[model samples]
Target chain A: MKVTGAVKTGQRPRGIETSKDGKFVYVAVGDDDTIEIIDAATLQVAGKLPSGEDPEQFAIDSGDKYLYVANENSALLTIIDLATRQKVGQVAVGIEPEGVAISPDARIVVCTSETTSMAHFIDVEGRKVVGNLLLGARPRSAAFKADGSELWVTSEVGGGLSIVDPAARKTKQVVKFAIPGLRGEEIQPVGINLTHDGKLGFVHLGPANRVAVVDGISHEVLKYLLVGQRVWHGAFTPDEKYLLVANGASNDISVIDVAAQKVIKSIQVGEMPWGIAIAPTRDR
Target chain B: MRLGIVVLCVAVGWCGVSFGEPSQQLKIGYMWMKPSKIRVSLLDVPADNDGLAGAQLAIDDNATTGQFLNLGFDLVDREVSKGEDPTEAVKELADEGVGMIVTSLDAERLLAVASAAMAHGQLILNAVAIDERLRAEDCRGNVIHVAPSRTMLSDGLTQYLTWKNWKRWLLVVGSHDNDKLFADALRRSAAKFGAKIVDEREFKDTGGARRTDSGIVEVQRQMPLLTQGAPEHDVVVAADESEVFAGYLPFRTFVPRPVVGSAGLVPGTWNAAFDQWGAVQLQNRFVIKFHRPMSTLDMQVWTAVRMVGEASVRTGSADVAKLVDYIKSPEFSVAAFKGQKLTLRDWDMQLRQPILLFDGRNTVSVSPQHGYLHQYSSLDTLGTDRPSSKCKLN
Candidate 1:
């Protein structure tokens, strides 16, 4: 629990993800419209990859062969071949695309557009959109079930979560949250995370300053853990013992005990913290 | 309604199919009359498609969201000439199956259109008329206001000034009828917000071209001289809705003071320089598409059209009555890149939104300034509250 040396990347950095081997980290530089690669070992700038306009969120395949980026301004998903470091194809999507999630098998990718409120499914093999599933308003994040049977998308403005039947390309169910003493419009659902076993789910309620714990199997709300202001994005540690959430407005991170379903600690972070990335524990 | 069927068919045909389901077309009508006004600055001139552009952009945005829901949106724009009866225009759009119309018209024309639309069982969203009567004594159940009433704008500006401790004000009002009405709103705001108007002066409109080579010297000399010897005040509030002398009051005031209201630091629902609360994405998209900055009128029309889209999406249908009821319901709220969700006032069907204080180049601040709280929503602090509102819609 200490501070690491910071590496300046680019302006308005949004989504971040580590490579499968945890060797490199990719950051979507939104304002710069390029994905910057950071060498995890050296904690230094590695290289840059060309992306579409206003790239916010992206997904890397399990094989780490390609990168799929959601370009908010361009309304296109730019596919980059990791090894070649070149954009291979572009698939037109709905407006203001923000979230990207690839299935466990890496055969399918789901891109969620904020304004369009659609979860577009793309075929990795064909490098094209296969189908689209409509959800609530302003869908910001997406996560697939461990078995790839269901895709869960969070609608920030719609204040609900839509669980889609991935194979059939239809919404299986929608889970809405109603907190006591809070208005319905305040219950905005943003980032979502599911346990490795897929038995539990954690949803960061943006501006609501709370995390909803859901029974993964039942897709029902189990409990709510109050967090910081504007709880934007979250990530689980490699061991999956604790969950860390970035509070964009509060400029801090709330650490939750996965087993206890409670907030254990608050860690101060950079101003307006957004996405979070955790690397594998290494021998000191 | 043969025209309505033809337009509806074209809209549905262009949208094609969404995931094998034929798209359900939803058309919103845009009816407006261009305001012919000359301003001191070329930048202040209104674009030919000021409000229409906003509706067009909203249609594009709605269509994007509609794609996933098997819903499609289209805009049918109808422009009326001066002294033209807008009833025919309203009927034409209604005949085309357009159940919702967004208008940027004067009070008279807007009222006429509303009456005509009500006959056809269509709803109207007023995007431009700021006359208080439209939201008060003349309030129509069928006409929902997207534009902030004059009192709302005045209150937004007054709150910011009051928060800044600039409580004393020198009011300069134009003689024109609209300007006088705006002046009344400012007077009401100053009284309600605990600011005292130290003194007031009237600026008569001497008929002449707004722009001329010798005009600047004359205005420069006339403004300060007219403003001279006025009671001491912290700010000079101008009410020149006719685009007469407000812009010239900023730096040309006799006493060194900040100018506000119709010029200088102004209050509006949207501005070209607003980039907060994820508004930059919208501004960027608009600039890329329209090749110009988005104006307050544009944003108003955009909000009006999006309101229709939101209702259609929530109710999952294009039925006019259902959508109207849903919009007027407490359940309906819309996100317009504002920090919080905007809801319509159930009392008068006026959209409640945060007003931006623009200083021409950048957003100076937003109204409902911190600490000005209301029991329900802080936004209600800027406009006609339910208790004070004269609107009686059943």
Candidate 2:
């Protein structure tokens, strides 16, 4: 709705997430192979953390004890200890690993590899990969269900969404998308979001310029909300009233009214925006 | 620290279970002729591993994905020496049990090799030789074209020029036969795109020292004299495949008109300056491995190798017939960081992709420009469409 101060990080900053208290924001600077920590109060880069080769996406655990980063070039999921600011463990998954999601219980972590087209399940406590489930080609993002019962992974090139049973380590179902005029290759599913109640899902269709609203329980397509070009990722507001999507090519963010399922505003942003994270509101 | 135990678990069997089947070896052949011609500019010189390096990179890319599929890829590159028979070299590759081949051969040699490979049920991916007839009158069922055709390149450039309202062109032709052929393509494209060639001239090759230390001063003086006295035109289009004069036409033109064709704002499948559509990642990988920028031939060969990898992944087999069948099918599409999936035309077996119009330092724009529409794909507007194709693949 309005302009805000911006902080410049290293080249090609991709994934961003806030700490539990929202005091610091960790960003995976992909080209720099490091994470830039931005202090919330100052809105400036405070420090840097050692990330593995070409870190694309990372997830912070619920307990705020550890950070799981998907090293895209190294094919390893690097675990970093928050308190000590040290590399704690590494689990070899698949090639071009990206799209990290830590389960609600903080016991399981899902790492999706782009080239290998597999979602690897890691035992956070054991510091090892427990299971692997192959999905569509070029898997880009992973999101766990509200209760951590299922995992949804977006396959950018495969143009589908895969729902996996984390406990059984099997793909339970796959939801495919199709638009009337667009070709199959244009329907690439990139970033996925699920409602807190687990009743609705929003799948970002890259290049197709539309966000698919799905019936989360039945996994059926509800409607397609038209948005900006090359939508990469999205984030829900702290109140869940709006969903803000970063359009990479358009260099803008489209704000959609979650309840109405329509675009309400388009806020201009920097060039080729990839990821978005909304921190909780603080008292003045 | 539990690093040792956790690493051992993954190293031994924990993560290994994710891979399916035992690794099956997929061997591919890369046949190329050593670059024989010297360029006018040192920057235009071809590297020793020009085409082969791209195939090697693709092999590594394939192996990365192959690791999860329990597949292993190996590239066996063979350089054909002077007076060596390319057909025999292809047979040698077949003897080594390599059924898929990516080649950077001339049109004649490629046809002979394709004929020889047909007996062994091998598929040939043509990574060089942009002769339009190869995709038209000389089309073969076993040969798939990765490089853009001459007409495609001409059309790509012409579309952009037309979009800019530069309809009048002063066409310059070189004396060599290859240059003449490219000039024909430019003429065809100009006619198809409704652009008029206001004037045409030929620069005869008189056999002189054009690459000397003082050649720049001579070219700068001679270019303006040569380009002068032409009819009214918005651009100068030079077709000089022999590298005789096109490079000199830019910035030295008499009328200060922009240049296009083999010179300024050239149309190509890939350019060193192109970094959009996830191409920077590829460029970084290539530069890190080869210590050089990826050339157009390298990108074409890379696309060819990646096509084979994609087919194998989709069909789940290394059988030559299966791979060829899947690649020729309509459902087959391979991504080469081109912003879209490239598919083969059923009639010509030419890969459909957007051509980048690039200068020496930057990619100015991509062709198949907006407002150029087609019933099926806008990419069809670049070259011979399905209805007008002379190819009838068996």
Candidate 3:
């Protein structure tokens, strides 16, 4: 409540990632080649790390040791040592990368580029490009199960999803469909959410303005749930019982019952609050 | 039949023709839906917060603008779900022979609305959805996007961050897995403009256990340490979509730096508090219509409606296709909050406009302020330009 400034950055920020110990908060300052860190208490800046150009997408290792940033313009993954907060290495891949996910073991990182039609994986320990798996056209964001066994990537242009196997370094499944009352092309699939158990995954379809529930194991789209105008991403509650979709154009968050797969409420945030994440309430 | 054929061709590509001469009822159809039940708490939103506020704004705006042209416009709001069959909803509107429709649904729904409208040879004026895919792979000739794409919004924010010289940042996210996705956008922006992120952290959504008083003190103590050792940072950026505690960042932070991104300076389509350049006047009018503050959804819908009014005043009829073409033309302009004017890109049908960078409380600056120039138009600096766009108009 003390620090007052402008939120004159990013478009619909989705995530609010804090340190493992809940010390610092890292925000993806969309469209800028930088991230903002604030002291959790005073909410002040303690430092800055170097990311690639146009870095909107990012991933952190298991121990929170390494931070991987996907620079959209340079099309490379810039790696920084969390301990030093300095750029240590880089991995070049794809065009206009937007989404980033790290393996459960923190051994690998996956990034999805907007137009590249692929999600590239990097070996976190070696800091090198290790995998490039084919996906639906215009993949924007991806989701990795809590255990890191499987991954789901959404294709905004192709209106589908690509499932990958981190252990096998291959795309295990591809799911596509045409829902009524939507345009085929605009039926772009984006934003994926997986349960902790990795049994159910929710995807926000770009043009469809809805989220599709998929069986994570078989990569089958089980059902569709209405979200909002251009629903882009989903933010899950700590209990995983609720899921909120950031509807880019609707300029609000559509709250859904994950168990029911239906929107129960809609809350107004700032305009296009695309990047969203829910943190466990402090034990206050 | 021959004469009818010629008339149809002329209608398909009508341009610069006087339409106001004829007092016609402007026909329009819209498509929308209710989201699933689960998304409520996740977004920290309420159910009644649907974007209908935008639809109301358009109707009010037209009420003011309609006096000059005598163009009577009426909108029939049709709500549909995933399996509800938009074909019928769209047909009901098209059956009325409404050519142009302003919509605030997802990309697929818009496409369905567009196709259904087009099947009846109608045009769709999309008022919402910012996903780049709508402008890229899913783009259509019959659809004109009236909303600013995410690229535009992000780029607008990025330019200001670079201008502010607060190049270094420390980012914080919430526990939702999607926090990384937003962090991705911030990362991209940082990379493009030669900025840097000191470090990143995740705040777990460990359920609402705030009845006691242990979490805040611990988080307060822990945050400063995590950000330690980063040479220097200019700002603290927090992406708390869940609004867990990042809203409490800034000032409490260990170091003194300007915080931007989500909490500090925020970029959006429209803000209820935005009044600079008399933006409050528009806001007031919108509040009168919906009895609540207007959001980005209302703004986008207001823009689409205002576009119709602008083109109708200039071209004259509800001849939907003709009006659509007028909007798509580079010459078209709309008066939004930004001081100057806004247009549309020919290649991808993206809106060309300036962005208002607000420091949470007030407006700090606007992007593309003469210094930021592009080869095509200054608006090119707002988002992906012709050279960078892969959208091919078929």
Predicted structure 3: lDDT: 0.67
- Which lDDT tens digits does candidate 3 get at residues B165-263? 878878877777445545666677678767888787666767754434785676667657645565678887766544555655656677766666556
What DockQ does candidate 3 score? Answer: 0.01
Error of 2 at B7 (Å): 9.3
Candidate 1 fraction of reference contacts recovered: 0.31
lDDT of 1 by residue, A137-159 (tens): 78889999878888899988778
Q: Rank the candidates by lDDT, best first.
A: 1, 2, 3
lDDT of 2 at A56: 80
**Displacement of the residue A236 alpha carbon in candidate 3, Å:** 66
DockQ of 2: 0.35
* Model 3 spans with C-alpha error above 4 angstroms: A1-284, B1-22, B34-50, B81-88, B111-117, B173-181, B203-231, B239-248, B251-256
Q: lDDT per prediction?
A: 0.86, 0.86, 0.67
Estimate, for each residue in B1-394, the C-alpha lDDT of model 1 and write its tens digit.
6466445534443211224332588889998888775777888788887888889899988877676677788899988988688899998998899999999899999888888887898999999999999989999999999999898899999999999999999999999999999999999998899999999999998885556679878888989987999888999999999888898998899989999998999999999888876688888888988999998999999999999998997788888889988988888888888766788898888888888899999989988887787867788998899999899995
Residues A174-257, model 2: lDDT tens digits:
899988877666788988888887788899998999999988899999999999999989888877888999899899999999
Error of 3 at B172 (Å): 3.5
